[model samples]
Target: MQKKVPQIVFDSKKPENSGIEILTIESLASRKTEIIDHNPEKAHQVAFHMIVFYTQGESKQLVDFVWHPVKKNTIIHLSKGQINAFQFTKKLKGYILLFTETYLKNQINNSPKNEYLRLFNTHLFSPSIQVPQDSNIIRYFDLFYEEYNNHTEDLNQQNTYKSIYSIIFSKLEGLKQFQPFHLKQSKQVNIFLDFKALLELHFKASRNADFYAEKLNITYKHLNTVCKATVSITAKQFIDQFIVLEAKRLLINSDIKSTELAYSLGFEESTNFVKYFKKHTGFTPNNFKKNYL
Candidate 1:
């Protein structure tokens, strides 16, 4: 059995300081149908981007939107902060390739293709993409996996791997050029995504909508409009969501007491946190912990 992944941590240690862990299709190929029911309560931040090319599968991928009918030859982009879950039977089989965003940064710096750069760099504002199944694109994607696996043992492994990954992203970028659907303007999407980024950084400091708007240099009205346009929620709703999520994560994942957890999240008193959480989530923080954990 594959060992359970250790408690996910966001480590800032340099890459060379900690040897990278690489997973290959040939290694995970036979086990595609296995179910991985666990999810990170809070998505783990990764230095790399994840490209999951599904050749055969029947599963739902939760990205910016939910993707279902996961069949032969589908590709998905998973950027940071997109929480996901998986339920698979014996039919799932695919290649999941991960390499640092630094790889793409290097590509843009060297070759400087506008369309390619735009697609990979969308995470600054939008953090996920779901690509349609395309036969031609699938062929190139398979080549990427084959090329990486076949040349993995080279003396200059990192260099060879880099070349192979570059080729894969270059080919993948072509899909953007000839997409069947008109991809929505990503800038519109980023307004909300960047707001979420702000939430991650400041949820503990303040849960007020005006606080985010001030930092973003936009009026609270504009912030609320942007969030409502994208996610059908108000800015305050999003802020509350983040606070509640963080509250739950700390409550379940740590041994800290409820009152301390409340104080850590910026509540002056534990009772106030309890009242606030109950007002928003309809459950006291303690009850949420008892039921959910």
Candidate 2:
């Protein structure tokens, strides 16, 4: 039987009034435990953006079946539709801020959309960052939480939250700037971004680099150049990496059969899927599943 991944929505206190919810680590853990206990196979695919600030204690979380360690001063940002499971200790202390894409889209200006994309949308980078506990990042989160709780229908109050949100992204941008191989805007960067967006849309049905290049209205050579310059990988490699990652996620988190998953992933034969998975990951799909389990 193919087990289904559960879709989780933000359980806001006033669902009709706001699309945001703020809860502490303890609260989130309790609620998450209850849900998982009721349905052990419920692998959550959240439909909203989540920003988690870990202020104390150590914990682990499975994001898309990858285990990430959480510690004091660790901040993890998860975009919509990513699967996550909480595995934190009782001593964990922090905040989990949840907000819908619609709310963020309506609030954030167009100027910072690229930065937003780099931070939130890009799967090439790790979604979590470790920073100083007393840094301005935590301060901005504190301000956002305070403003979120005090939210009103007043335009000024709403703008206040938007302003704080912008500041938070600014802080994230600053942190990213200091990291090695940070994203920079350029013609190649723009092309690569567009290619990534298109790949996400068409990867299942079409994995050809030329197909993506045509969609981007550029030559395959140009697309490859852009991808190599932006991320030090060929365009074909990028596509394969994305597909293999998705395959791993499914293999570990669901009970989808190999033949069915192969067809679903556009492979004409299960043997071809096995060969492709092994070529990229050095392990066949079944081996990878066994290792993961």
State, as a TM-score between 0 and 1, how close model 1 is to the true structure. Answer: 0.65
Pairs that collide in candidate 1 are none
Off by over 4 Å in 1: 1-49, 61-69, 74-76, 80-85, 100-130, 151-160, 163-194, 278-293
Model 2 TM-score (2 dp): 0.82
Structural similarity to truth (TM-score) of each candidate: 0.65, 0.82
lDDT of 1 by residue, 1-293 (tens): 21222133333233441222234333454554462533432222233556666667566554432344455655666554433334454677777666555555665676646545445543322333345555355555566556545633455665655665666666666555444433444665667767887887878788899998998899999999987776667899877766876676566555678799988998888998988889887998667656644
How many clashes does each candidate structure show, in the order listed? 0, 0
Residue lDDT tens for model 2, 187-258:
888888889988888888899999999999999999999888888899999999889988987776678889
lDDT of each: 0.59, 0.77
Q: Poorest 10 consecutive residues of model 1 by lDDT? A: 1-10
Clashing pairs in 2: none
- For model 2, the local distance difference test gives 0.77
